[model samples]
Target: MTSSTDLRKAFAPTGKLRASINLGNPILANKNPQTGEPFGVSIDLARAFAERLGVDIELVVFDAAGKSVEAVRGEQADIGFFAIDPLRGEGIAFTSPYVLIEGSYLVPEKSPIHSNEEVDRQGIRVTVGKGSAYDLFLTRELKLAEIVRAPTSPTVVDVFVEQMLEVAAGVKQQLEADMNRFSGYRLLPGRFMVIQQAMGTPKSRGSDASTYLAKFVEEMKASGFVAEALHRHGIQGASVAPAA
Candidate 1:
């Protein structure tokens, strides 16, 4: 039977890993504003996988999170580091979620946002990235806030920077990067959507290879190692629970 080593050695992901790292999203994927170095959760996961398999990982840029998924489908990336969703699972294999993630609201400094009640109290303009998971969730869950959809992730960032306001995204690292820049970022007391996050492997892999890697990922999750890695990387906001 081919082991993880054998599969990776045989199919070492070729090409510059089209790293779909968004520009402003901090914890997931973003080039450092100061050093021009890409440092984030996605980078960490990709680096770990490459090291484990004795391969190399070269990062290429993707403008947004959704584009990252496209990169994998187009054979530009071996994988992308971000939350694995059921919709995405349709054509992919994902590692067991390392951290418990949730979607919440982040507003500008002292914006009279006292509770989830204010989600609709008055002129609450919830700006969101186009085609983002948070946009989908807000569409389904939010009743009162006016959803101001930005054309892209960067557009969303620009909107928030301009208004000093916007709703918090439910995604990880992205939220940390988006909301943490200002002094007034808060988790919005008791208001967030539960979003379980996992890593993704593209659908292009053969069924045999996919199943084998899935089992391997399950084992890693069971070992409680991914949690340690997440915490080590300054992404402590993700709730780390023992492997199920």
Candidate 2:
């Protein structure tokens, strides 16, 4: 168990816990259109962690996960919310995921790609967010399909439409919203992958911090704080991750 002093020393080295939040992922965070302030599950989790550490919280907001990850890597933020990926693990220590998000494909309504299995074929172009977990996973897993990376995840659908790509790979909820806003777009029946969303700190922060965060995540899941945050924020299509 991490002592309270150790938790504070690791999580708030600069006298406050700076949490890097990614606004690009709407499922984890939602920006208030009028106020431009972010409020969602990720924010709530960050706040709760800060409270646990008895430290002030500072939100370092970013438009994308790449930026958020960069902040943690650079030690610009003490911690960040990220998808649990081996590639990102090199620089950051991650806890078991507190939420599970589905990664799926979006295609034109009249497109012949009726099943997820049909996606990996010759000459099929799939657009994904550059450096995103889906991009990293598909880069290794995709057998035949060519992956085209957009500037970011939030922009993948737009890039797919503009480039006339065969498929758009991204968060299922984002694609569902796009299907409603744009005409003649449909999501594939099931998810291609499940993204494990977790909190991470710089590995250089030391093992004590990692252990504390991992335990904290399990506590939040067991206590229903994660589920309550999702319900309070009106987020759907996601569930609290199973205990580690």
Candidate 3:
């Protein structure tokens, strides 16, 4: 294995960094759709990367991290911000667990189910985006319950809307009604796991990239940019654990 010193030299040949962020809403990156200026938590993190690198940084925005990851994997971009998932791990290297993500089931109040555990006890179904990280996790980890996967993100939104209608019309909503009252369906407490959302070049980029970037990331962590980014975003519960 290449030593960390070697890795750092590769990542910061001139002591500068180039990174991108996902501009999707609520992602901590909200840049102009056309011009691509950095914004939000992801942008803030990028700033830290630049500051620590001691070089000018460039920022680009994408529709979402899923797309941004493509840029990183292709080497069109050096790094991108995104959520942690098994499939994404296949394509890109992540920094470390930089943030905590809390995912919960949403439904109208006064539904039959009171907690998330009750959903799997019966025949209730859950709707989620097709091929999404959440969908993958639910299918792979929560196999006890049945999930009706929507074909796309829009359809997932539609499912939520349809559920809202069901509640408005007094029918047990598919997703909008209380997870329990829709007949024992509900989201459970989000599992606590370290989702290290790290950054790396493509596996094809070779060991030099990983080795170098890894050390730079460690320095970024030690310098407190990661923690400051988390705090700036009011992410008190999330963590910035050391990846190395």
List the candidate 3 regions with Cα displacement exceeding 4 Å: 1-18, 25-27, 31-37, 51-56, 120-125, 129-132, 144-159, 163-194, 242-244
Candidate 3 C-alpha lDDT tens digits along 143-180: 55567755543345356556542111111121232343
Q: Locate the minimum summed-lDDT window of 10 residues in model 1.
A: 15-24
Q: How much does candidate 2 score in TM-score?
A: 0.97
Q: After superposition, how far is residue 179 of candidate 1 from its true place, in Å?
A: 6.0
State each model's C-alpha RMSD to the native: 3.8, 1.2, 6.9
Model 2 clash pairs are none
lDDT of each: 0.61, 0.92, 0.54
Order the candidates by lDDT, highest first — what do you get?
Answer: 2, 1, 3
- lDDT for 66 in candidate 1 is 70
Candidate number achieving the greatest lDDT relative to the actual structure = 2
**TM-score per model over all chains:** 0.74, 0.97, 0.66
Off by over 4 Å in 2: 1-3
Worst 10 residues of 2 by lDDT: 1-10
Decide which is better by lDDT, 2 or 3. Answer: 2
lDDT of 1: 0.61
Q: Estimate, for each residue in 132-213, the C-alpha lDDT of model 2 and write its tens digit.
A: 8899999999999999999988899989999999999999998888776679788889999999999999999888779889
